[model samples]
Target chain A: MQDAPPSLLAVDGLTYAYGARLAVDHIAFDVRRGEVFGLLGPNGAGKTTAIACLSGLQRPAGGTLTFDGAPFDPVERPADRARLGLVPQSLAVYDDLTALENLVFFAEMLGVEDPREAAVAGLALAGLQERSRERVRTFSGGMKRRLNLAAGLVHRPELTLLDEPTVGVDPQSRHHIFEALETLKAKGHSMLYTSHSMDEVERLCDRVAIMDTGRLLDTGTPAELAERAGLPGADLEATFLELTGHRLRDEA
Target chain B: MKPRGLLSAAMCIARKDLREFSRDGVGLLLAFLLPLVLVAVFGFIMGRVGGGGAPMPRVDLALLDLDRTEQSAALVTALLASDTLDVVRPGPDSAPWDEADVRERISSGEDPYGMVIPQGYAEGADLILLRDPGRDLEEQLVLMSLVGALFDAGGEDFAWEMSKRGLEASGLPPELTGRIEAVVNGFRFAVEAMFDEAQANGSFDEDAAFGGGDGADDDGADGDGENAGNAGDAAGGNAVGMAEILQLTLPLELVDVAPEGRDAQLGYQVTHAVSGMTVMMLLFSLVGFGRSLLIERDKGTLVRLLSAPVPKSSILLGKLLATFFTGLLLVFVLFGFAHVVFDIDMVSRFDTLLVLTLVNCLACTAFAAAIAGWARTEKQADGVSVLLILTMSALGGSWMPSMMMPEAAQAVGRFTLTYWSLRGYQGTFWYGQHWTDPEMLQSMGVVLAIAVVLLALASRLFRTRYVRT
Candidate 1:
């Protein structure tokens, strides 16, 4: 059998908090090289907080984040920061700027060698080259979503932390985004994708980590997770429900 | 990162901000246009109401000509010409009203004071004044107006008699008083002799000799020193001869010694309006730029920026640079408007003006950053900025001259940046002082110091609000 791919990033006992309340509680996971690792969780499951810590937006209260076989603290090391990219859940583009302008600006900010060329390439990657000059305010939600994806990739970082990137996308735009991600995966890019869509997670992620209330419940491929939950024919969703229960998590 | 890289990032961000701001056409127009309109309106109103252009309120006085003589009619015309009185004549030219009519008006409170020319007034009969007892201020005003009219009517004789009476009231030793009286008589004789010679020559233009007519200077005594000196030169020997004659009549001599060449007309009201409105309005503009920080955070652009490889200081420095340049533009725009509309002398002092304005803008930019850093939301920033800015403007003499405020308030005004900034500006523009002057340097130094403290505070607060978790 082929040896498992070597790890590109590892999180050991990662923890974070907002004042007295813990937002990310001692969760650990790893993304191997050329792997699309999925972090599946419901609302308030600490997925976004973990992503924030990784992106250097929040300082970890206690934990170790190792990247490329070395100690990683993006907050202390801007070089490490430049290696990682964040696609925030919010539509973070300047509405007044055109698609190309937003890409170029973010690209330059990320220390890309040639921001203009990268921006053009990013626009094409998101299938938005035809509308690159149009202001984001004039774009549809799907188009904006696509552009937001392209913005995070403009710098071509090794690891991209996408926090619910397809939350409110139309199916057509969603399909295009899936196709783009597939292409990136083929190019040996690693992504830490957090999503609520079961089908997309199953189809895209190489290995999935089921999390709830800041704790990781399980980590395995879809079939292995079903077998471990003792429901051999059940899908990943059934395993998630079985492990995390049917209770609603609506508050953070 | 290198200093150049940091500055480059800041410039890039400022360019982006300015480009976005440019697209807001209505905001751009209102930013420059509203202050100009306000400056024009405030300048005009203050000029009129602050004793620059308009006369004080006139008191109404009723008149009844009982004597109906040439002298009484002349007194009536003089009273009508007095700026202090609104003369109300009782009857038409065909028939005049009696003293009873004048008394009735004063008693009924229809007019505060009334003048009645007694039956024998042309032959030195005294004029009777009818007045209401309660209106003391109005009564005094009317009496002063009457005295002025009487002086104009009597001319040289009235002045001579008044001076003699004043001398008698002084109760000086009889010998000294008599000797002084003789000197005055000689002066009167000398004046009559000069007049007689001028009349003989037919060269004495009555209006020109008395400094009357439209060609007379506004402040006939002393206006522009250069113009006055020129007039003294043109008058030459006649003016010298008149001065010697005038000196002989005086118990205490008066000297017309003023600075040789000083610009007394500094356009003070225009200066106050321009400086006050510029400082106040620029605060509002810079604070609005500060509010853009909250806006960017709300719009999530700040998050994207923070997540990038740019240093956090560069982000803040970029915002500061943007606000600084924008504020500088606003200051020049308002002053430029004043220059065009009010004909204020901005060109001569442009260098000092630019330095003072640059420092002022830096202070304002720091203030903007502080406000943005302190407030959590756009609405909160708006409310806080208005309250603080207006308070500063009022306390710092942006609404009026600090000298006009209560002594305690003026002392308090010294603590505000607006006060120092306006003092620097007023010194440069209104008082014609150079930037190297102690007071000007002090203002610049204090403003720079305030900018430093505020920038430090802002940097801390921004780190807490935007950078740290």
Candidate 2:
């Protein structure tokens, strides 16, 4: 009825290459406000490169990225990247810092004058309020994953990019991660989550894009992707294999 | 949250990095402990330098006995008998080196002091000291030994030359005067030889002898009480009565003051050691800081910061500032350690020392930043940094004095940052040069300029490889 909240981001004709090997070729996508967009691909896919271009960490060979109907040029200034947040697949937080301290530091980095309150909120969001004083080095893998997520949210950017946030965690930890994302969604933050796990994607993502090598194959809702693979009633795994192929990707 | 400025971001980053560094227990231990242990080891090896002066300290002299006359042999024997020096001569099978070669050897610190007796040295007893200009104490000893020998030879020449002329005009028979003159010259030689013997026994009270005092005795305390004065008086009184016919001798114009006053610098070995050790430690610190850049990228923190509301340059500046402060802290700690443990005079020229330290830290940080920018991985950065520090230390006068090094090696050393640092330090502390000296200022400026240029280059070369799959 409200025109389904305007698109918070727009991307078109994005291209990136490693040497002469093209990794992301003329890909395009959009993320609506307060909606979770899933980016899925197998290993060696262009998912990471695409995310890099979107986050302003790498320059695209060609294309444009717009945020909130405004041109967002990462090459211009750091403020261009201020509206975006990226949680890398690897743990990026300092291991020596305590949970609250980590939150405080990240919050301050984003220009928060008093980070204590935000840090506290982040601790709560990550379900680590009780372990606020503990160093991340001593944290469990799940705890670190949660803290990592907490750090990205400290700046409270309009768009958050989550890259394999729960890849190596236990099921219980995975549940915690899902809950955290759901909470962010409830707070009206758009997310771009990358995952290989079909169930997690099915449960959280409103729409998904599947890519391989350097090109996006298709993008749609869970049922739409299933049908796009020509298996109208099949699950995401069948659809993913149908689109991305069953052959294994090369390993270095 | 409000958007942040670049400076604010840099501060936050610096604080965070410093905090992280502080928590690395082994790193902190090595940072603090390594310098202290190194300083202790060097100090112990150098041992305590001599304090106060010892009268007529035993010196090592390289002597070339070119003169083969009996008189020349007698002079050498007198010198050996007068134990002020352990006279070093060429081995029997060794070839004779020229006076120029001896001078070159002494200047290179291959030999401390040397003298050459010319072919006709028996004629007038004129000797040339083959030495660099900066040999005050040594020069005086050489002069004293020469004076003792020359007085004997000159006294004989004076008596014979005068007896052949004046005694004949006094109407004495020439034969009779020659015999008397021979007796008088022999007695005079005996008298001078007695003084030489007293010197050899270390019982010569040289101060009491001349009252020109302490020219012969570097310190007055070691000589036998009144013995040198008594001997000089007795010998002079005896020689005066018989050697009335002897001709007057030339003035003993000895150059006892070092032309450059550089002898004092040789005593500041500890200061030189501290400067060198500090340079090496600062270099290690630079390596650590350089590796931190790669580590940050590997950990994704650098990429994450790029997304923050601050310029990309701010990220580099932030890390550099952090490293600069860290390096500054390490430098202070090391100097403090040296001061407390080894009694190195770090605070004597506190202001200049502080400025040099900051400049060195800045240079080292910039150097490390460039290495980080150029390297593709942490291991590459580590290896390159270590190799650089080792090579620079070895070639840049850190392990030894540049003065002792060969001319060509010294020339090459001028290109290393460590050379500039040591030069500045030695100039300031050892040579007692002021900070306003052109050479010192130039050294500082060059190091600072290096920092600026390298930092700019590093910033240009640096690009995050954040999109790795």
Tens digits of per-residue lDDT, candidate 1, B60-87, equal 8888878888888888888888766889
Backbone Cα, N, C clashes tallied per candidate: 0, 0
- Candidate 1, residue B381: the lDDT equals 91
Q: Pick the candidate with the highest lDDT.
A: 1
Checking candidate 2 for backbone clashes, the offending pairs are none
Name the regions of candidate 1 deviating beyond 4 angstroms.
B1-4, B47-266
The TM-scores of chain A alone, one per candidate, are 0.98, 0.96
Question: What TM-score against the true fold does each predicted structure earn?
Answer: 0.80, 0.75
Q: Which tens-of-lDDT digit does each residue in B1-469 have in candidate 2?
A: 5777778888888888888888889988887788778866764444332211112345677777788788777767766655356687767798777777777778888767887888997766557777666667576656655555554555446445545667778888878987877887788789889989999999888654422222222232222221111212222212221112121233332212221333322335666777787787787876786677788888877768776777667778888999899788887887788667666556766787788888889988988888888888988888888898888887887777777789988888888989988777777666656677788899998888888898887877675433232
List where candidate 2 sits over 4 angstroms from the true fold.
Answer: A1-4, B47-213, B216-266, B341-343, B464-469
Q: How accurate is candidate 1 locally (lDDT)?
A: 0.81
